[model samples]
Target: MMTVVRLMALALLLACGLAQPASAQVQAQAPAQAQLRNPATLAVEGPVLPGETVEVAIAFAPREGWHGYWFNPGDAGKGMELRWDLPPGWRAGEPRYPVPETLFAFGFMNHVYKSPYAVLVPLTVPADAAEGPTLIGVRAEYLACSDSLCVRETAELIGNVVVGADGRRDPRFARWEAKIPPRIDATARVEREGETLRIAIPLPQTQALGRPHVFIAEDGLVQYGEQQAFYRGEDRLVAVLAAKGDANPSSLSGVLRFGNSGRGIAFTAERGPVGLGSTTPLEASNAPSIGWLFLAAFVGGIVLNILPCVFPILSLKALHLARAGESESAARRDALAYTGGVMIAVLGLGVLLLALRAGGEQVGWAFQLQQPGIVLALLVLVTAITANLAGVFELPTLAGRRQASGSFATGLLAAFIATPCTGPFMAAALGAALILPTQYALGLFAALGLGFALPFLLLGFVPALRSRLPRPGGWMAHFRRWMALPMGVTALAVLWLAVRIGGWPFAAIGLAIALVVIAMLMGAGRRQRGGRPVGGGMIAGGLAVVLALAVVAPRWIDEVEADAGVLDPADFSEATLAQAKATGRPVFLWFTADWCLTCKVNEKVAIEREATRDAFADAGVIAIRGDWTRSNPAITRYLESKGVAGIPLYVWIDRDGEEQVLPQVLGPDSLIDLAGASPKTPARGTPQ
Candidate 1:
């Protein structure tokens, strides 16, 4: 909510416009007795020449725990006002303020200078003015505020400047000028869309940015307290800001604060198209190189083989590995074929992801699982695999060539299912892929595929490892049948995911389609056993499945309620996050999806437990749950902001706004320990 003070300030600006000087506004609210809590003094820097401009500095030294405002006081507070009294034909320019720190108090944002600071105003002398000492003075009025209190202060400051005398320049003027932000050489462009303002500023790609912030000088142009999102392209920086009310202006002027370094660049933006360019986050300048990202992706892929989501697919691969022990050449061939399959699948998905994002889609890793159609397809495929494992059907083996094809198909399935479960190093690699260049990003994806296939590839090439495997025997059949159990479980999980993403009706139709496909497969198996042709049944079954999907696609709608757990967390949103942090309570924010097995595992082990719940209750923790079961732009943006591509992301923001990102794998005591940690005193305007 916009505060009344800010609203009134904006209304006054709209009514009076820029033509009405700040001094008049100050005089309207001036107190009879001046408050000098934050004392001000005036100084002239120079031996001013007749027609030249010399800077006049209004220096302020605020008392402890008190601060003065900038030219634009942000959401609330009064900007300093100056009523200049100079000789005829003399002129004064607008006051130039140094970059100010942000203060967040009671849901309002204030731009203030806490320590000693100066505002430089250029005073231009007339060409006809006498070359002699002249008196210059200003009645400065401003607001001084501590954390809980504010006072309107006024001061009458005077300075003398000798026009013709050779007076030495004040050394202090150099320091004051350094504090002021210099104007950028390139022009910036801004565009307004509804309540959002997007500004594109040209900057070198090599420029290092740390938590960049934009301070718009135009009153009512933007909601000062709203979170600003920054992104970087090849040679441009884009800033997204929320506009305040219905205010629309032809041009905008502001200062771009480069993190907390007290350095900024002043920019004026005119109405124009602002291209978002790449989805790269501004922090990517500090990100690791492509080689490191590739290595991380590879390692992450190896770890995925151990997660529960890949177990169903790994079962088939295990059998393939055992068969590889037969002959070295055969084993190598199978390995290469399987590796090719995995690479093709992983890279294909990566290409699709990149293309969709380029086409302006808000999506992330495991994005296919969000679609009901894709989920249904997966369910049907897993069901067929389960039936084959259970001996209800058998896929005909075509000697060496068939073996290779089977390995390749298995690789494709493994990569598709395994990608959803981000393990260890995979998150960072995948997150960087979203912002990296096309060629480099594709390399990372290829690295992930190669890594995933490395273990199997090794088995095919290394005879020593192959010899260690148990010899193919009569027990192999029994093992395959037992493997059906996990595959069956995988099918059930996919069905559940379908229900979670779509409604019960959609899930029911999908289940019927899967059953129809399974029945057709079983019929074909029976025919094969009876030594008859079975191709017609499979073709008919495929047609039936396609027809059913076509009929139900349009009617699909998401109606499933969010999963309930012991924690009883609130649904996450940007507004909710802000409100939670504003309360000065510890926040436990976790992102999950029905399709993510790791997310569920963490919930069962660490989150949805009586101990964790009690700890949170005792600590007064605010739990926020972000469900990514469907395509949510907000959740996607939040994940990108945290430098991750997918979730099972657990972020703990303490009362003081310090954030600690918990690991993907959570222990039973992880949340318990977090809740028990000592609280720190909340700091004003701390970044969350």
Candidate 2:
């Protein structure tokens, strides 16, 4: 009776199992949530040729509010894990992904794609395969998430590709391929600083990378989703990333993301010091070393002593040295003081320049002369000097005084005027100074001042040089008078510069101030000659009024129209140069300042001449001039790019868009010859 009952129970259980529907059982076995989301689809890009490789893409189109993870998913998601099913003699390469966007949800950061995207895998066919269709399949495991919910999904994707003699490309493949970050020929250095890693890469200093971010590919090296700090050092791009615990990878590999372009480059980290390689125009990889730069600065200063703008001043100083011949001890003392003054002046100017740069001011050589007020002040001083030289006043104390202060003042004046000329070798040294360490830059300036004062310093020590100078006599008076002519010319040049920089009205006011100051000086001379206190008081009051005017004039003067016929070349801008180069035409670019006499001479001789202009027009040359008359940061940066510290920077770009740096001092035929010569594409770094 028990055997019969047990058999009945087993038969009833079997009947109940048979009654259930097969589709319902299958649906119950697989989670209903997994079936709700669509699976990814796989497709071959095009026909695959035997022995040739073609792209096989696994594409996913997420539903609204859902997203897919990138190769290196951040914080809280899983990337696509592919299990490939391939034919016997076939291979599949690693997946290539497009740049990813950041997604934040529930206190977790994710690198994901919210829209449809494809991951590309290279599929290779067997060399001897027959012309037939082959099935490629992949089992993809990924995590898909919306803002509120997340799900782990599995998709079985398959595609068919035809093996043919020649392969055809798919349009979809091109789109995905374009999105993948390009591999860059770059090296990086990872510097571990406590809890942060400074990853430095060699990128162009000129690139405007706005708030750049880094996406590390290596696991556990960096804390993803943490804020990245970016900085630029010379030519290196650096990112400060929060480190994950004590994890330090032998090499860091990553992608650098700029904004909205969805463009980036993959870089493999090089194990070494975090070097901000050659961040300056002067410190370019191929530029001269520090020692050579110092030598260049010294040599440049020596050359400045002979430039036309400086020649007259040297003559006056030399004459002063001759007057000192009466007492060797006094001469030596004066020379020391003058050298001290020169060094002090140069270093002081250097300090000001560095300070301004630190404060983010766009300043360069002779920057002080850019201001109308300073120009007017210098004009007055020079005019007064000329009058004294011409015997309008007996201010022989300037050079003939036994006091060291007079020599000191002369040294300061020499340095002041010397700023307007960039001698041979100066452009490189000074440009380097701007980018070098602060101390190194100051050292260069000191060397330059030492060179400028060398001649006078030598005369004090070497009695033979001093003996060579003619003894002081009445003829010295006549020589001094003749020097007044050059001094007056210098004053007139300042006046002209005032007009160029501040316009005609400013120049007119400067002229009126000069006349008034000259009259006051004349009155003081008369007072001394006639022994009259009344004349002295008149002179004092006149000077006060002149000072007041000087302080007030620049603020009130109307900047009027500039004089024409001086070759008003188109103002040079980066855009202008780029546009000119894009036209496939040659370009002539020159940087000039109102105060740079060498620049003026070059313009009048080479650029402004009729022959040069005609040649430029005929050759379709774009003539562009950068006026450094004011504090133009753009021009300053451009000058630095060419390793130039001062003006008269002439750059010639041939039709091939190669830059040729022309000589600083150009002759009448220089531009004409340059323009007439047919453009030749230069090899890398051929001297301009």
Candidate 3:
């Protein structure tokens, strides 16, 4: 008896004490990425022969009104730079850039690259060339600028070759040369629409350069702020774009910037689609690949259905429903019946998919992945329910118990969650599914869902499977208790994603509410059986959860999405912010990462303060601010999203927003005027 008592005490100590370490570990699940997503594409290549220089460049594919500077950035924008990851013997060189065009913005005129451009690097090899093959790799970093702000980034590009007695073209070098982005065809037509521009280029296959950029010189033609290029059919590449300023179709003179087998170059464009009047060897085309796409997506669905984060909750939900199953005498019979439900639901989805494909409908890999609001809502709901199960809060059982509950709920959740986990089989399945006939698509989906569910279903139908499970006894209790830990972990995760969208306040409120419910339940548990402590635990639990959810539900429903600000654009005018910069005074804009959302949204809406009309007014501010948005590439490198995982991105080009950042939110008057306070010398001729 003493021994058993001692063991129980030991187990309790471990669970409670180690919970912190476990929770901390769970929180750290976020990836430690090396770089933020930036605009420039990195390039690296080198010839092994002595005296041969392998040239490389950082290419910028800008949307419009955007340009980036050479190694030496002129005026306010950042300079393009390159880094190398090569072997010991291989030597790297700096960017050998083409002379830049003069860019005029605000009151400043600086030389930079406009449209898509590349920098050349001349690599030098020694007279004694290496006998074997050598490899060279590089990262290209550059800033792409638009009228509003700049996006800086480093990308990976690679090239390698063998060296011999004399400098000669090697087959490997030839291979890379082929991969070089092909130039834009000379014969293409540019068309302009409201906030959108389309360039029709004739092509048979979609080339990487189909979205190649172009500029329009005519008044009222071609928008700058929005530009997107895609292949609309099998015969042409259409560049869709947003029109800026005046956009008149006729009398529009456009210039198309594209790359040929040789390098980046431009061609003068006339208004209208490319008439049959001209034809080039190059044509951009992308026919729908119905068969392959469906196959890939189906495969992806299969893989994702079993992800760790998803699987546990699915099993438990089904288990709850399974209790309601009428048959209990034979466990095997119960398991088989549950298995039937899973197969039926999964195969049914496959049939539905086939029906859609028959209608010539287009489906993307997890086409449903784009709905952010829906994703967030589901995540919150699932995690919250799981939290309740873990004893974080209590709730009345919504799902009836039955053998089918575990299997049925698992099947349903698996199907839904599979959308985001496409991998491996994803490519082929999705490709085929989208293009194949309805019958074909459904067949592919069937294979995928069936493949995914087979393992779990097999385990269910086979009672011997119990042998694989830990023995159900005192250890089972320990396992159930430990299981609660994962529930807490899952709840924390859902809350984390929520924080990114809803901010820290929402998360804190959620945790706090759950806490209260737990407390109340504890209090209720002390009641006698007649009135009941059994359900008392549940009452306290439910209250804690409801209180937190009370805040969360309303916030979500209200959808109060505004830029969380240090500048509080509502507090100041764009013209006002710009005027501060024009006085040669550096207007410091501190884009806080989290009081609300990532710094990106407010960063763009706020930083691009001086629209064309206010250009001269806001020239002095450097727009130097920290980015705290989720997956914000620029800020990620600097560990800039320093506060909460999300919220109230503060602006401080003028003032640090230190006081505003305090209490973790922003308000007006929090703005500190720079000219009157800081004694630092002001910048010259800076744009407002």
- Which candidate's lDDT is highest? 1
Give the lDDT of residue 579 in candidate 3. 51
Residues 1-688, model 1: lDDT tens digits:
3357787644544464522345643653443333466888888998888999999999989988988998888887888878989999999998898888999876778899998999999999999889879998889878777665565677888889889768898877766765676564345789987789988876544333456899998887888889998888754678999987776667989988766656566778888887675647665643355666788999988888887667657567766766776678888888998899999999999999987765446678879888877887788888888888888777843111237887888888889988876888888888777766678779989999998999999998988998898876677778778778887888887887778888787888778877877787788779888998878757686767767675775497567779667888888887778777777878899999888888888999999999999998788788899999988877876675555678778888788655667889999999999899846444333223
Candidates in order, TM-scores: namely: 0.60, 0.59, 0.34
CA lDDT of every candidate? 0.78, 0.71, 0.43
TM-score-based ranking, best first? 1, 2, 3
- lDDT winner between 1 and 2, please give it: 1
**What's the lDDT for residue 371 in model 3?**
33
Q: Candidate 3's residue-wise lDDT over 222-251, tens digit each?
A: 333233455444335455656645664643
Model 1 ranges off by over 4 Å: 1-287, 397-402, 535-538, 680-688
Pitting candidate 2 against candidate 3, the one with the higher lDDT is 2
Best by TM-score: 1
The CA lDDT at 230 in model 1 is: 85
Write the candidate numbers in order of decreasing lDDT.
1, 2, 3
